[model samples]
Target: MPALDLKGCLDDSPKFRKRIAVYEDSIQHFEFSLKTLTKLTRLQVDSSTEYSQRQQELATDFTSFAQSQDDPIIAHALEKFGKSMIEVEKCRTMFVSRMGQAAYNPDVKPVIQNSHVTETFISPLEKFVKETLFPIKELKKRFEKASDEVDSVLSRYMGKKPKDPTILETAKELADARKGFYQVYMEYVSKLNDIEAKKKVDYMENVLAYMYTKSAFHHQSYEILKDLEPYMRDLTGLLNDTRQRHDEETSESSEYQDLCAQSAVDIYNPLNAVSSSTVSSPGITVPYHNTTENPNKSGYLFERKGGRVMQSWIRKYFSIEGEYLVCSMRNTKTSKDDDQSASYNLRVCSIKLSDSYDRRFCFELISPQRIIVLQAENEKDMHEWVNSLRMVNQKALNSDKAPPPLPSLHRRGVSDVTPVIKLNGFSGSSGTVSDSDKELLKMVREKPGNDKCADCQAREPEWASTNLGVIVCIDCSGIHRSLGVHVSKVRSVVLDKWETESIEVMLELGNTIGNSIFEEHVPSDMETFRINPNSSPIERDLWITEKYVKRSFVAHKDDKAQETVNQTFWDAITEGNLAEGLRYLARGANVDYRNPNEHLQTPLHRSVQLGNEVSVEFLLQWSSNVNEIDENGWTNLHYAANSNNVRLVLGLLKRHAKADIKDESGKTSLDLAVEHQNVQAVTALRLFAFDKQHNSSPANSLDFGFREAMSSFKQNYSFERSHGTSHSALDLRQTKSHSPKESSSLHETGSKLLRSDSSQ
Candidate 1:
């Protein structure tokens, strides 16, 4: 690469510089014109469809013009200009889409015939001022600042010459300076880029704040305005009064100067002296007491005496003639006696009052274990008396009694003794027992004679106990019986697992019957052996491992039995059968039974997905927990909606099934109906949403209910009639198809109805 001289390139020609300047000027004018035109067009356009089309055209034109420019600086400017145009267009589109044109456009001519064209003409100017031209002003200021900086640099380098330098000389000097200035200018450009990025963030924040503030103002404007009315009235009155005072101040008269002076002496003199003396003066002396120990503790008693002393001192100092001499007290203490067993401790303190130039006193006496203050007219006098009584008592009380320590574990001994066993047994010769024992013994010794029917209380004399201890009569008992059916049913209804288990166990124990001899002397192996018929197919195929039991029963070995079960299952599902299927399932038939090579769907799934309403309803009634999702990740409602089966959707929704369930494509039943333009299905989904909103807790009023209904109708109408399809059965032909008289008649009728509805 060649190392080109930037200085030489700059110094080449003044014409080049002039060309650049002219290009910038033209670009600025072009931007302003384009902005103005855009605003005018936006104001005029009534429909979003037209606005979007116009915006696309504007973007294409600006982009084309930018691409046509060859100069790098001009091209860069054009690119920025195109971006600004695109941004404004985008903002316009967003505004129209969110708020609609009716909000942005205002009627300009009420006197003339009502028309949108008048409002449209003024829109371009509004847009230019609001969006485009306002931003341009800031851009112009920045450019001006940059131009000033460039001029300053040029002047500094050129110096104060006698005359203006020649264009060539000036260009050469600027060109030389431009090399270094460009580097610095580039830094400023980088800073501007940072500022612009921050401004974008700040602009977005401001827009959000403005939107929130506008919403809040809309909600509270009435209340705020109402509150401000009274304050505004009061402010007006005050302003008027101030103005009157200002006018009259230049025309006032003075009088009663002597009377004012006398009133000042009578009232202000005493008040002034009181106010001045309220705060303590720096040099004012207050009576204080010093005692042997803690004299201030009894200072409250010296308050009156201190006041008298202060009055006396004040009178003496000021030479005022007053009968009462209220002076604040000094110290008042007496010496200790030689016969005293303890020392006296006095306490004293003072409080300065702001309302008067006097200090209140406090005094107390302290001993080794107790404190006492003497009551007097003032604290200063109390302090003197309290100090004299300080030696009365000063000693601590003593008592001697210690608590014992806690005992250790090793010190506590344990005793071992066997408890006597009292066996309550039935009377057998010498072994005599009580009546309760006899009853218990009989219950334990007697055989479970009969298997009691839970429903009728009928006893079956000939009965046998299964391995599970369920007592059954020979007639009712079957080889295929298992505990799984009962367990499953119990688990389904009962919420607590442990509680269900306990109930099942108790029921089994109560129903079981056994011979008395076997009950009392049964081996552990007998209890461990279980004849489980409801075992899984794989488990049923295994041979019995117990050596004691030589043979095991296998129901599948009988081909008739297997065929009967399969036929029963098929018949149950075919007849839209719920009871038969549940019976078969409970009887240990294969639940995953298939017809042939086709993908196997369970009886529950088939009845739910494709069966008649009665069949589905029957299946649901039989098994409340048959929740099956199909191969397409669709529930029953999805299949029903896709098939436009309104009744099925209603049934499923009635059963609390979700309508907005998304399929494998992430499309819900509503979305699918919308995609297919199924009016009935869409209406059903919307009605469901409306009902949900209406039936919500804390029911809404009639207006809200009507509004919700209307909204639902509108939404469904839009969805159905979106692609220019007639929403209703009414297919009224256009007026153009008839004569002018017919067209006029139709227009008049339509206008009347519109007016009537608008009035309502």
Candidate 2:
């Protein structure tokens, strides 16, 4: 490169400070803008679909702009600008999410306060100011001082002849100083030219063209705060009377509408529209990805032991989908084509380090009410699972449209739920439904609104889904039912029998209520066609599957309730599920809980009547009172004595149950056993009564009960598996069942029972 003429005419004075001050002002403005954005971000106006879409659009735009930069300095400037903008967006998003949490949960502290703006947004730009712009400003002052020294020397030597010795010496000094100052000016101009073109002379003119676009985006984003922030109550996290913006999510975005139209269960996959791409159950899809970027694993997870089921490792496929980490279970028995792939909508899934005390290489995959702990084969696989899931969790959090939180189905067919029109007639009292039911029915009868069929939006819909609680037209009901009862349990409003509490569930979860829970984050705002009541089955099937099964339009709630209701407390007694009862006991429920609607009887009384010998044993293990009476004055002994189950009767008796307790009819356990002609039960009780009669000494109740227990144990005793199963075997019948002290008590009781029998 040829050295350009070193002559510089630019003046050196306090005037250069004025030029530098402008850049300082710009830096301050940028920092202030970032601070403002950080403060605004905490508002969490996630309901605005346009803003969310715009955010993604901005990211793509930034990428393209960065790519287009050719000059090194300008590229670096754009790069920093893009990064700073991204940081601002990130800070804003986090703030909104925190604000959203605070809105729903009073307990969660407000998002990280003003530091959100200061830390992520303002700090970065301020650093840029200090490192880049401030240095340039300081150098400009030095350049001015150098220029003044050269200028004064040159003026003193000007108009003097070369023969003058003073003039010649001053001229030599000015030239050397002028050369150094020229270099400083060029370097200063180079840095300033990167962020702004101040003039074409600053650098190659085209180098800063991209700055205009960057500036425009920042201005647009900055102004957007004014439009949306007022509607958000918690930018500062002050108060309430707030409601979720489900309507905004549904009514405004066409792109989401397109995604909804495309994502049917049969023809589409929320993971992608490939058929049976991965092994998955309803809402837990681990999608199959072809790219090397995503990690795919066929692994195992221990599903939490639920009602009457023990913990078992389930085989599953795990995949890293864009912004979503999905894990799906596989079933070998399923031959259906769709079942071959991951059919679950794992949109709402999340991850955490395992709290598992016993297992190693484990982490938890969480969905709405469901949590699964997965164990990797080794540390490498565990890290992979953790890293991929965390990335997707973060990715999904950044997205404006997150997948719906689950209990979502993956079956694609015409198993449409009937519209929940008429509340079931069995709504508690007088063989009638309540006014709430009537009001809901009246609303259902009104012209179709947000409450209409989720698939076709058909008015006068007739069926409902028990899980999602959304009503569909009768035509769509067939489609939902086709997905099978596991996917969506379709029920009728006027035909099927309904539990009073179930009716209450429907009442509390009508269309609007259902929308709030399932459609909290709406994917699209486009209106969809409602299937005519007479539409073809195929059409209804496709629509229903797309709407409910794939959950194309469903968005995960920012603030869904995570509290487990332990509803199984009542279900255990009704179903005689021992595991279910035990789970509640472990969760600290009352073993003596009486179901007021079920004759005010505790679970023990119910278990005995139902002949659930195992359930009764499990309930008793929790220290339930065996002699507790129910509404009819029938104790557990009374119920067991009249039943055909000899095991249940024996189990109760071995627990030292009171045989003399009377029912309302003055019938004792022996009386009921004999009266009912229950052969085995009668024999057991007769032996107990005979033993009692023969041993009529002045023994305390404990001794008398112990003797009866010995007789019952001897009668029912069998040689089953005698080692691991010993303690599991009922009470005294357990082979090698007791310690020395316990054995001595049993031996003494057995001897007494033998003496009583012989005496008799």
* C-alpha lDDT score of every prediction, in listed order: 0.38, 0.50
| Model 1 agreement with the true structure over 374-451: per-residue lDDT tens digits | 234344344444443332111111213232232221322211111111111100111122344445333322335334
- How does each model score on TM-score? 0.21, 0.21
lDDT, model 1, position 479: 16
Model 2 sits at a Cα RMSD from the real structure of 33.4
Per model, how many backbone clashes are there? 45, 30
* Runs of candidate 1 exceeding 4 Å displacement: 1-571, 589-600, 608-611, 624-627, 675-677, 693-760
User: With candidate 2 superimposed using the best TM-score fit, by how many Å does residue 616's alpha carbon deviate from the native?
Assistant: 39
Runs in model 2 with CA error above 4 Å?
A: 1-121, 159-162, 197-760
Per-residue lDDT of 103 in model 1 = 26
**Compared with the true structure, what per-residue lDDT tens digits does model 2 show for residues 259-287?**
55555454333324332444333323333
